[model samples]
Target chain A: MTGDTELRDRQAMMKAALQAYVDRANAGDADGLVALFAPDAVIEDPIGSPLKTGADIPAWFADTVAFGTRITPVAPLRGSHANEALLVFDVEFTPPGGEPMRIRSADACTFNDAGLITRLRAFWGPGDIEPA
Target chain B: MTGDTELRDRQAMMKAALQAYVDRANAGDADGLVALFAPDAVIEDPIGSPLKTGADIPAWFADTVAFGTRITPVAPLRGSHANEALLVFDVEFTPPGGEPMRIRSADACTFNDAGLITRLRAFWGPGDIEPA
Candidate 1:
């Protein structure tokens, strides 16, 4: 494949993966959500949190599912010319020991050549989260 | 300063800089827009395009100003735990040899410790652009 076509293919894959991510999360399917990541993927939900990798990933998503999290797209999924895609969404969930809250989250994901997400850095701060 | 406070300060600066970016762009102030960048900043306007830096930065904004680009924030500016912020906005402009168009762009910006934008990678694919 030409380099240009290959790049576009990668971009398409990343975008599709982002949509799948939302679907899986909304469906509360922790396994499906974890499957979107590479074997050695790393994630920082809310950016400032500790990194979650390997076994931490599955556990993290399980917590997310347990929180009854629901993600709603705020804008169209953004794809870069490279192996990155941005998902802008609003999340509503109740965290442990916390009230129901809505968070305006923008996840910046980097994908591997195989289109599995290798890194996900979610952008959200204390100010972005508000009581629902 | 404690690490937590320092990190929060950086996050605040990044988020403010993003709001300034939107304000400068909407006001058609190319100079103001360029001032937000660090001296050695780099930008990729559509992710797939060539990187603009140094002398190219001013010229790129000049073209942007000439196009009368109007930026409207679609979602609240998102701040990370680090020196990064995400700006999700819609741009309305007329490109050379093209009709008026609106692009849904998500700019992932990395900031220097001094709060200037050091790297800006905009994520927007062809499908994200629509006739305005």
Candidate 2:
């Protein structure tokens, strides 16, 4: 295949991988969610310590789920190169007997040659739920 | 010009623009430094308020010079598109009769269609200089 074709294929795979993570997370499938990352993937969430490996991802996910946070990953902003992409969107969830909170975040994802996510850096603001 | 030639020209222009900023800052030429940005440009420094418009940039530059800060913009990490670039470098300076401080920062710059810088977002760690 040509270089352009290869790049296109890699981009498609990356998009699928990112969507799968969001799907499994929202579905509360911890194992499936963690399986999307590489063995030594790094995830830096906005409000938590960075997770450096696959082993640590499960605990992080568990904590997020425990917090009653649900993430709905939106469409990503494609970079010029297919190896990198940026996803910006909002998340909504409710705490125990409390009103729903909405958070907007931007995640920059870099994919390895194997099409697995190597780095996922998330950026968000810390604030309480504002009335809509 | 062809697409590749156009991209190359833009990249060279951007490199020159960034280097000019560093040179002028190091030489304390505040006027020349601010001339690089567009009239309505926006600059978000690391430890200060954002400066909007060309008029606000001089005060910001003057304050930085007064703080004994010297910025040396190193090479940029080029994005896929020539219009966007990421610059990661370190700055070193000493306060009045105090030890020198070195700070590492990353700036993402976006250029307008005319190739003038429209947005400059800076990121850095707040700390003292460590031993080399």
- Native contacts matched by each model: 0.67, 0.00
Give each model's whole-structure lDDT: 0.88, 0.60
Query: lDDT by residue for model 1 over A74-126, one digit each (tens)?
Result: 98888876777899999999998889999989998999988899999999876
Model 1 spans > 4 angstroms off: A1-4, B1-5
Mark the 10 consecutive residues where model 1 chain A has the least summed lDDT. A1-10
Report the TM-score of candidate 2, chain A only. 0.76
Tens-digit per-residue lDDT, B5-74, candidate 2: 6755665666567777677778888778777778788986542334556667778777667766677544
State the lDDT of candidate 2 residue by residue for A1-132, as single tens digits. Answer: 126567557657766777776777678777786677777888866423344566677787675666566776443333323365445446676655667777655555777888777887664423312432
Shift of residue B8 alpha carbon in model 1, Å = 3.9
What is the TM-score (0 to 1) of candidate 1?
A: 0.92
Docking class of 1: medium
Clashes per candidate (backbone, < 3 Å):
0, 0
lDDT score at residue A78, model 1, on the 0-100 scale: 88
Which 10-residue window in model 2 chain A sums to the lowest lDDT? A123-132
